[model samples]
Target: MGDLAGRWRELNRAYWDERVPVHLGTAFYGMEGFRARPDSLKGFETAEMGDVRGRSLIHLQCHFGRDTLSWAARGARVTGLDFSPPAIEAASRLATELGLHARFLTSDVYDAVAAVEGEIFDIVYASFGALNWLPDITRWASVVAELLAPGGCLYLAEFHPFSFVLDDETGSRVTHDYFDEGPEASGGPGTYADEAAVTEHNDTVEWRHSLATVVSAIAGAGLRIRFLHEHDHTFYLQRQSLECHDGDIYRHPEGAPRYPLTYSIRAEKA
Candidate 1:
């Protein structure tokens, strides 16, 4: 976690710090709706992670804790970890404002073990667009394994590796090599939350990981893969040619061949 990945984490911290306020005010996250309803957990995740009512759940790379608090509202003892101090601070504020019980820790995913001083959880939950920010999936899986109790599970929902290989603008071409082991530098004007919002630290580094690589890493970390599912739709608008459905979810337009846009995994420490 030193050298290049460390530098990339620093850059990412800046990028995420700048995004905190923008995301809080954006319609995508719907902070107002979250405040009123306080349930931001996706149906898919909720269904997969059944009965979190008394479970201890740790959310990795939890940006502003909306989803984490959502778990809190559902009766889970929740803890959130992020590298950006602004995000952690904002999450703390949001928890206090909503009167939800949750803890926010500022630490890189690689340092999460030390941040919590070896506390274990019943569930280690991470979601969409989280894995690309991590450079070493093997080490990340190790961290996930370390954080979970003996019967605990890691529940992950993420943008699919196949989709990550395709060009995001058109979704018709392969813009990047699918199997590249890289800390590829990506930067531009806008973010997924708000296409028009301006930011100074828009650039960030990310890595590509194929599905096999992901599965191998998790298995290497002593977790048993319970199930893997790929979906034809995404929770957000990922491509220009994609069509939005009733719930802000997006998929390939009608009459078009479907492609895997997102994937979820359930792995357990046996």
Candidate 2:
């Protein structure tokens, strides 16, 4: 298990290193839109988190700092952390170019917590597709708890585990086990980014985490659960058959079995 976890981490690091450059060139992130509206955050994030007028925020696994800068523009003293150096470099450049006050650090989530010791944040924030990359949720949760100030909270918005169960082989069918523990490998086609572009990297690794495991990890870290909100809508079109209502949210087509598409949780350090 230890060997597998180490290998998975190595694969993820390589994947992200390769993906950072591609993601920067893609339109899905809306670099132009971000430049135009520096404060524009994902609707779900801002709506759920409310106002951050004067607070310190630490964003984990912050890819390229779009959302991190968004928080800074909203008056939060923001620090963005990611393992990929290219992503951190791009994020730092973006923060400078936009004239937004944000700090970008290049470190794995675990090391970043210790490296930035003596600093506590009012909020530890992570969102979409962040948790699965981690091999140990308990350690990740502990990192979140460690950096959080007294009365500070952690916020997460992620794709529901059920969404990962869909069979992407040929047609939509339930195949993969939601509670499976082993590593799943994917050749990088049909990503959330442009489906048309062929990626140079072929394989990436991900772990399957259930809802119970997610909640339990945070609770075990001594954080009190505030709320766990689930929604039927997702921020992106995950499946080919999914119908998009306004290009912002997607849902299954008619008669499709309904399932939670995304979920958000806020946990406070006690």
Candidate 3:
């Protein structure tokens, strides 16, 4: 477990440190909208986890804290955590600029839960594209369960496992095994920040967890599954032929009848 956490920390730090600066400059994060309105959270996140007013919320893998800050503006006592120092620093700065009350921590998820003492959140929130970076969903679920106050809720909206099976390099082709546990390796052409721009990084690593694995892990950690919802829309262009239909939601132009692009689930710790 120590080795796994260490390796994850190394990969996440490298990946996110590089991503933070790029993401800040992009419209994908709605930085300008956030600065102006202070309530500019991602549509997928806002639609799924509604009304956090006066609730204590903890956002895991909260890259640079746009969503966290947005939640704070909506009156949630927010704490955003990320393993990347640059992300935490940027989040803190953004919170300060917006005059939003939020705390940002730079620690691996496993360690951050342990480090933040005598505190439990009313809502534990995470969003799309977060879980893949984690190597161990069981441990991550345990940490979520631990940080959640009794009867508190856990909310997640993530890219569906079905979407991951498709080959993004080729248009709408099923190329990767859905249940495969082998490490999927890649050196970046650029991250999802700006798909049109090509930026090179010598290293990037990620692990994918299946839907069954994710649900079992959360349930195994003593959380009760409330509802699991699947959707055909994605927040980004997953492949060359993907078309954005309603501003943010994207899908294959040719339409694959079998797969969904995203899923959302809510669980309660009791």
Report the number of the highest-lDDT candidate.
1
> Candidates' TM-scores?
0.95, 0.92, 0.90
Q: Which window of 10 residues has the lowest lDDT sum in candidate 3?
A: 1-10
Tell me the tens digit of each residue's lDDT in model 1 across 1-270.
245465896788889999999999999998988899999876788888888899999999999999999999999999999999999999999999999999999999999999999999999999988999887899999999999999999999998888866777778888878878677777566788898999998768888788998999999999999999999998887788788987788989888878899899999998
For candidate 3, write residues 1-270 as lDDT tens digits.
Answer: 344345655655776788788899988877887799876555666777778889999999898998788789888999999888899999999988888999988888887677578589999989878888777899999999989999999999888887777777655677888898435554466667776655655355577789999999999999999889888777788765677886777776654454687888899998
Ranking by lDDT: 1, 2, 3
lDDT of 1: 0.90
Residue 149 miss distance in model 3 (angstroms): 0.4
Off by over 4 Å in 3: 1-6, 40-44, 169-172, 195-200, 254-258
RMSD of 1: 2.0
Instruction: After the best TM-score superposition of candidate 3, give how far the Cα of residue 107 lies from its true spot, in angstroms.
Output: 0.7
Report the Cα RMSD per candidate. Answer: 2.0, 2.3, 2.9
What candidate 1 gets wrong by more than 4 Å, as runs, is: 1-6, 168-170
- Estimate every model's Cα lDDT from 0 to 1: 0.90, 0.83, 0.81
Clashes found in each candidate (C-alpha, N, C closer than 3 A): 0, 0, 0
With a 3 Å backbone cut-off (N, CA, C), the pairs that clash in candidate 1 are none
> How would the candidate models be sorted by TM-score, starting from the highest?
1, 2, 3
